[model samples]
Target: MTATIDTMISRLAAWLSRHSIDVLRVSLGLVFVAFGTLKFFPGVSPAEALSVATLEKLSLGLLSGYAAQAVIAAMEVFIGLTLVTGKLLKTGLVVMTGALAGFFAPYALFFTDLFPGAPTLEAQYIFKDIVLAAAAMVIAARALGARLVPVREPLERVHELRERAAA
Candidate 1:
């Protein structure tokens, strides 16, 4: 059982190294672009309410309605474009991280509404951004030639990577 699990893990890692970055890049790019595009048409995106409300609250009610939604949509599109083309990757990752951070805000700020005993599907949806963030972080770190790892010695290696990048 242990050997089988190890074999599977090794194969998965090999597959990821061989092609997963491109796949993740394209898939995430498409997701961002498609979802953002949908925001242009009213009544399409389900998260419109949650998103706008979160933004309004974060912005102290300064941002609300379609105008605020449009900005968010534009940011998603920009992140998608950069990721899809593999250009301005650092910028794209930064924007993506920021966007996901916003998506994560509901769990923190609206704990009661999002989690009255059990979290709503909406909260689950927002929580999935953590996985996306992890994927993006992997790709971003790769783009920077920085190897953060679950497999390798992170403490020693990450320090080495930072020192190398800094030099």
Candidate 2:
């Protein structure tokens, strides 16, 4: 029974090691596309008002209202496309880094509004970006030739796998 359980766990881990990063990347892309699509239509996205305001402030009033929203929407869609298609992924990661900075800016700029006493819904919404950022980091590392090796795997075996993957 113990051996069976161990075998199951190892199989599950191996499967996750193979597919988790791709799944995360694709799902993240889909999320960006969905959210960006929402901004295209007014009164559809809950984050619409805050997103516009944040962009306006970030852009020093250069972008506002629908224009600001449009810029954000376009950026997100572009990121989504690159990630989903695995085309221009490095560029997408670069853009993602910048977008993440913008996404987190509100926490520093509007601390009081986001957290007057208890956390507001807006604060909660922004907090979820932390997970997205971490996932992006993982994807970026993988893109840069990093691989996940099981702990029990031998170092020589891992090197062989890396060599095979590179070739």
Candidate 3:
């Protein structure tokens, strides 16, 4: 059992490294974009979701509520853009690490009381940020730069290649 677990872990790690930064970029970018959009829902502003008042009470008043909300929004948009363009990807991942950590900190530390009724919404709103934060950390460690190689290929070429190979 132990040997099998080790082998599985090794294989997973190898696969993770082989696929590289685009995986991390796409995952983190989509998550931030989705969460950021959700923040605009009724009573669900970034400041509210982040428990900004709690942070202020904790003497993290240096992060102004409005500024914090703006930063969160900006980070989400910026990370999404970077991932799409494959530009300055490493720095974007590093910034994403900070943004995701900020998104998760409130639930992880202060708001255990607020999590029972809507399990899936709660999980996505809270735990997903934590998981994505870890992913950002992993992506940061990989240190992906502005990707020079084109990431996506048009679908037409794939079909053409298959036809030629079959012939």
Candidate 4:
């Protein structure tokens, strides 16, 4: 079972390297752009978001809330553009990972009350972000030139192919 799992992992890693980076860039860019735009929308007030009162309860000032939220929105927009243009992908992915960590830290460790009645929703949302963060991290690591394990082929078949090509 362990061997089979290792083989599968190796194959998956090879597959990721073979695929084009543009696909990942587009998917991540669209997500960040939409989310950031929503933050700027009139009805999407941070003070009224599900986590707002909890933030105040923790004694965070109004200005702090506004500033932090605004910074997050702006970063998202900037990262989205970076990803879509395939420029500075490593930096964008690193920023996205850091952003995810920053978001999860407070909510996961200190603000249980903010989600007192919506455990399922809270868990689902956090989990989704975790997945996104992992994806970004993976791409960042790969783009940094980490080598994937080679795929295996039958040895006899390899020799046969070489003989045919030599003819």
Candidate number with greatest TM-score: 2
RMSD of 4: 8.3
**lDDT of candidate 4 over 66-98, digit per residue (tens):** 554566667787778777777887788778876
Compare candidates 2 and 3 on TM-score and give the better one: 2
lDDT of 2 at 138: 95
How much is 77 displaced in model 3, in angstroms?
A: 1.8
Q: Which stretches of candidate 3 lie over 4 Å from their true place?
A: 1-24, 37-47, 54-59, 111-124, 144-167
What lDDT would candidate 4 get against the real structure? Answer: 0.64
| lDDT digits (tens) for residues 50-123 of candidate 3 | 54544454445776575555555676778877665668876776676666656666665556554666544544
Which lDDT tens digits does candidate 1 get at residues 104-136? 898878889888888888888788888788888
lDDT (Cα atoms) of all candidates against the true structure = 0.81, 0.89, 0.61, 0.64
Query: Clashing pairs in model 2?
Result: none
Give residue 164's error in model 2 in angstroms. Answer: 36
Ranking by TM-score: 2, 1, 4, 3
lDDT of 2 at 134: 96
Structure candidate 1, residue pairs in collision: none
Question: What's the C-alpha lDDT at position 133 in model 2?
Answer: 97
Better of 2 and 4 by lDDT: 2
RMSD of each: 9.8, 7.7, 12.1, 8.3
Candidate 3 local distance difference test against the native: 0.61
Off by over 4 Å in 1: 1-16, 147-167
Report the lDDT of model 3 for residue 26.
Answer: 77
lDDT (Cα, 0-100) at 84 in candidate 4: 79
